[model samples]
Target: MIDSHAHLDLADFDHDRAELFNAMALKGINSALIPAISEQRWENQLAIAQQYHCYFALGIHPWYVPEDINASLVSLENMLAKHAANDRLVAVGECGLDKLKPDFDRQQQLLSGQLKIAINMEYPVILHGVKCHQELLSLLNRFPNPKGGVIHGFYGAPELASRYIELGYKLGIGGLLLNPKAKKLRKTITELDIKHFIIETDSPSMTPYNATEKRNTPLILPNVASEIANLQKKTTVFILERLNKNFSQLFELS
Candidate 1:
């Protein structure tokens, strides 16, 4: 299984990154998509993907936008161009709106800019919307359909989630579903075709059943896969096979 989203460049995995990769290999997590947070981390993100077996996603995250928008955008475009043809750089993001934090206007502009890039290049996007689905949906409404992507760290309602579905995007189910009290989260997943579902750890953030692994790395993918299997009422093996098939289908990876 591919961990659809993770941050191996983050300091959380610095001490044990190699061990974590070994664990991911043992668990059969064949690949991961490490996304750049800002121009600051894009180089490190590329280096990690080169050293590891994973791929990288490039874009300036909403939170990183500063006062000089034009200059920052110029820099971001330069970064995107540098690795435009790199086979390991799959899709564009860890990018999207986050009204849950501050500077939402900035988020909107950055998200729109990245969406334009995704639309132009036909690259599937990796979103990070939080507490702003309506605004996000509205912002995305302006863009044309066939939105190639998944909304990472997804915890929105089924109705709003359907909007993304209608736009040809997948809803990601991750560590949050592990909580017993996640009745609403499970309800949303149960209501969808499991094929449209993408399982992710958002590692270094959303640790699944093994919360004991405080750093949240790809080693937890088997547990995340198991949790998803239990939620979908299928055996782990069946779920893994189906998950890999669906992932390959969505990302156009074999």
Candidate 2:
């Protein structure tokens, strides 16, 4: 299986990152897409990807937008250009709007800039939307990335899922599925095909409701897949096979 979105590059895994990767591999998670949240984390993300045989994306996440958003966008463009030939450098985000965050206007600007970069770079996007579905749809309508992307950590209704799928975006199914209280989300998953979704851990964050550890890890991926399998009334192997195909197709992996 593959983790479509995971912040494994963050400091949260500094103590046992290597050990965790080994554990994840043994758990059948062959790779993860480590997305950048800020300019400062890009090099470390690339380094981790290189060492671990993982893929990564470089873009400024909405939460980490700097005071000079324009300068950051330029740097992101240069970085993408510099590593254009690097097959491991896939996609252009972890970037999108969040309604709960402050400076809604600035967040829109940052997301727009990143979308433009993604479009120009011909890369699929790794989007994050929290209670900003309508806003995200509107912005996506304006930008219209043909390469498509995944809506990371998706927790919405069937209508919303269809809307994103219509736009060529896959719904990210992650730790949210483990929450017993996520009735609507589970129902939505039951109604949708596995092709429209990809698995993610979002490690060190979005801890599953049933998790024993405080911090999440990619090792939880099989459990996450099992949750989806139960929701879709399928076996774990069936879910993983299709989800792995979705992951490979999105990032153009062999």
Candidate 3:
């Protein structure tokens, strides 16, 4: 299976990154999508992908937007052009709006710039939207016909999710499913078609409920899939197979 989103290059895994990749491979997670959050992390992300036989997306994250947004955009564009022929370069983000963060306007501007890059390159994006779904939708409406992308760590009502799916975007199902209090998100998952969702761990961030501590790893991806199957009243195998197809379609993986 493919982990649709994961920051495997984060310093949190510096000590055990290699060992964890081996564990993930044994757990049937053959590949992953490592997203770059800053210009500094792009090389490390690419190195991890090259070593692990995975894929990556490069873009300036909203949280890491530099003071000179124009320079940051220029750097991002240059990186995209430089890696355009890299087989491991799969998408264009980990970039989107987050209302909770500072500089709301700047965040939108950075996100718009990256979205334009993704559109121009004909590459799908991996978005991160937190409490900015409506704003994101409005921005996405301008694109009209995008190459398709996924909204990572999605947690919201069915109607809101439908809006994204209608725009050729899939909702990423992550550790949020492990939360018993996520009634709204759980119900939304049950009502949506499996094709509209993809499995993700968001490792080193959204730890599953079964995890002993807050730290997350791709090893818990199966647990996420099992919970999804239970919520959908389907077998784990069925869920895995369907998600594999969804991953391939979303990222254009062979």
Candidate 4:
């Protein structure tokens, strides 16, 4: 299985990241995509990906839009160009809009620039949206990523999901699936085709329901798959295989 999105680069896992990766590998979670949160995090994210033999993405997240947006975009472009030949840099985000955050205008600007770069670099994007799906959809329409992308941590309605899938994007399903209280999200997942979804843990955040600890990890992925199986009335293996296939197709993995 592949964790389509995870922040294993964060310091939350520093104490035992190596051991954690081993645990994930032992559990058959062979790969994960660690996306950058900001310019400051890009180097560390890249280092972790190299050491752990995983893939990563580079872009300024809406929450971490730099003060000098133009300079950051230039740096992002240069870094993307430098890593263009490397397969480890699989996408161009963990970037998108979040209405909950301030400076909506800057977020849009940063996202616009990243979308342009993703198109030029010919890379799929790993997107994040919080209460800004309509705005995100509008921006995507304006600056579409021809390589396609995933809307990470999707918790929208079935109709909203169809909108993204129709645009050739996949939805990233994570801890939200394990939440028994998320009735609407559960229904949405069930209504959509499994091929349109990819599993994620969003580790160190989006902790799964009834989790022993507050901090989430990739180890919870099987539970997620199991939950999806229950919702779809399919076997866990089938869910895993299908999600892995979806991940491979979206990220251009083999």
- Candidate 2: give the clashing pairs: none
Tell me, by lDDT, which candidate is best.
4
Q: After superposition, how far is residue 13 of candidate 4 from its true place, in Å?
A: 0.8
Error in Å for residue 125 of model 1: 0.7
Residue 58, candidate 2: Cα error in Å is: 0.8
The root-mean-square deviation over C-alpha atoms between each candidate and the true structure, in angstroms, is 1.8, 1.0, 1.1, 0.9
In candidate 3, what are the lDDT values of residues 1-254, reduced to their tens digit?
88888898888989998899889889998888898899888888888889888889999888987899989889989998999888788898999999989999999999888889899888998899998888999988886546789999998989999999999999999998989989989998899888999989888898866679777988888988998899899999999999999988877767
Q: What is the lDDT of residue 223 in candidate 3?
A: 83
TM-score of 3: 0.97
Per-residue lDDT tens digits of candidate 2, residues 80-119? 9999999998899989988888988999999999999899
Native-vs-model 2 lDDT?
A: 0.90
Error of 2 at 143 (Å): 1.1
What do the candidate models score in CA lDDT, each in turn?
Answer: 0.79, 0.90, 0.88, 0.90
TM-score of each: 0.93, 0.97, 0.97, 0.98
Q: TM-score-based ranking, best first?
A: 4, 2, 3, 1
Tens-digit per-residue lDDT, 1-254, candidate 4: 88889999999999999999999999999988899899998888999999998899998889997899999999999999899888878999989999999999999999999999999889999999999888999999998777889999988889999999888899999998888888878998888889999999888899977888999999999988999999999999898889888888888876
